[model samples]
Target: MKKLFLLLLFTVVVLVACASPYDPAPQLLPSYVKNVYVRPVVNNTNQYGLEDKFTKAIIDEFMRDGRLSVVTTEEEADGVVVCEIKRYVLQPLTYDENMVTEQYKLWVLINVFFIDKHENVTLWAEPNMEGIQIYADSVKGGFGGMTEEEAREYIWEKLARDIVKRTIKGFGSTGGISERKVQD
Candidate 1:
């Protein structure tokens, strides 16, 4: 019985020793990246001024994160974040008794990338990144409903938060296969 107990203990120790932690993906943002310059967001959709709104939102999020300083120009930045708005979709969901729209779904698609200015190489890119939100139209009671501007703000905030989170976490460390390639 003593021999069996010792064997079990040895087996446990061996198993524990063999256990290894999960290896995360490589860091996309190098440690030298101190300031990030947010370029003007290119707007592909017909929505005028959306580019400015998204650009402002992204800059605000980066500032809020405080991981990297936001620079005004590429010359002052160690890295640059380029974004292109690809699509904007709004779909009416439910309808009121008079055929009035009562609910809507808003979706925004964008392509974003981070480039190291000194090396002039892409650190990471999230093509086709999407943000979506659902909102109700103003009802008779004027409750549980939001205006289009309100919905837009909500979606923008969420997207900015996501972008900042992904950027600050070193890009590829998000526990998934990154489409962006790293330079050796």
Candidate 2:
């Protein structure tokens, strides 16, 4: 019985290892989409300088991704990514001793659109998309915890990655992106 169980386990492992990876979302954009320009994000919320941070993050991410080329102008690019900051909110999440705020959450709602410059049409749009992060506050005000700017940076990184993934791999993708190279 032990010998049979071992054989069964080995067979299962082999099958699992040999199985192909699945892709949940289809490639909606054409293969020619290589050069991309990220527009300066418009901020509707009252948070000063927040849009600039998000825009810079997205540009830096696209340049680092290596799959898409980041261009300086829309006229010179194959596609453009437009973003708008719809809302920003910071709320206290946890309380420590004496009802002091210990943890806080930062949330932002954004609208995004990927436009094909040649076609002059939007390839896809994600409106009212939200990103959030939670961090503990410093006890004394400058040491062992995260500040508002740090939290925003963390959230910006997350949003930028998601935007790049959606634009390159297609929105709502579940599995890993199969294609790695983009035509120049």
Candidate 3:
């Protein structure tokens, strides 16, 4: 009987140790941000399709984060986030004799701002966020010969993920929430 009681107590202690600790200071997440407005991105670059692509990327990031309930229109949203595409350029890469050993490099620059409805304050502003992606081309094809649409697609996915990660990290840091790791 004594042995059984000791075993039970040990098991309970181990179970409790394995559980996660409850956060004492839970950050106040805005309940009013139940809906979000994603405005159309203003494109300053000559690139034709950059505006739509960047706009969709930001919306998708917000949706995937699961923290904010996103809405399409401003009328239904509590706040609005506006994004601008400042630059999109493709620079050619040339080798000996200007044979164009490699394909063009695509660079993208963006700016984002978030606004609150009731307080009428800008929550966040990130200017000059940039990303670069490169693709290779065959010798037979010149820089202009290879289509970079597929490359853009791949790069956009990665860029969107990075943007979300940065946003989350910034939120946590600014909210004064610290993450600590426990060793096994």
lDDT (Cα atoms) of all candidates against the true structure: 0.83, 0.83, 0.67
Clashes in model 2: which pairs?
A: none
What would the TM-scores of all predictions be?
Answer: 0.79, 0.76, 0.64
Question: Which pairs clash inside model 3?
Answer: none
How high is the lDDT of residue 180 in model 2? 30
The lDDT of model 3 is 0.67
Q: What does candidate 2 score on TM?
A: 0.76
Candidate 1 TM-score, true structure as reference: 0.79
Count of residue pairs whose backbone atoms collide, per candidate:
0, 0, 0
| lDDT tens readout by residue for model 3, 1-184 | 9999999999999989888665454334356666677889899987787778867877898798877777867777776777787888878765557574566687888876656665566556667877787766544564544457756665667666665554443433344322332111
lDDT for model 2 comes to 0.83
- Stretches off by above 4 angstroms in model 2 are 1-25, 139-144, 172-184
Q: Candidate 1 lDDT, tens digit per residue, 1-184?
A: 9999999999999888789666676565677989999999999999888989889999999998898999888889998888999999999988889998889898999998877777777767888999888888765444688877788888889988988877777675654334444354
Better of 2 and 3 by TM-score: 2
TM-score for model 3? 0.64
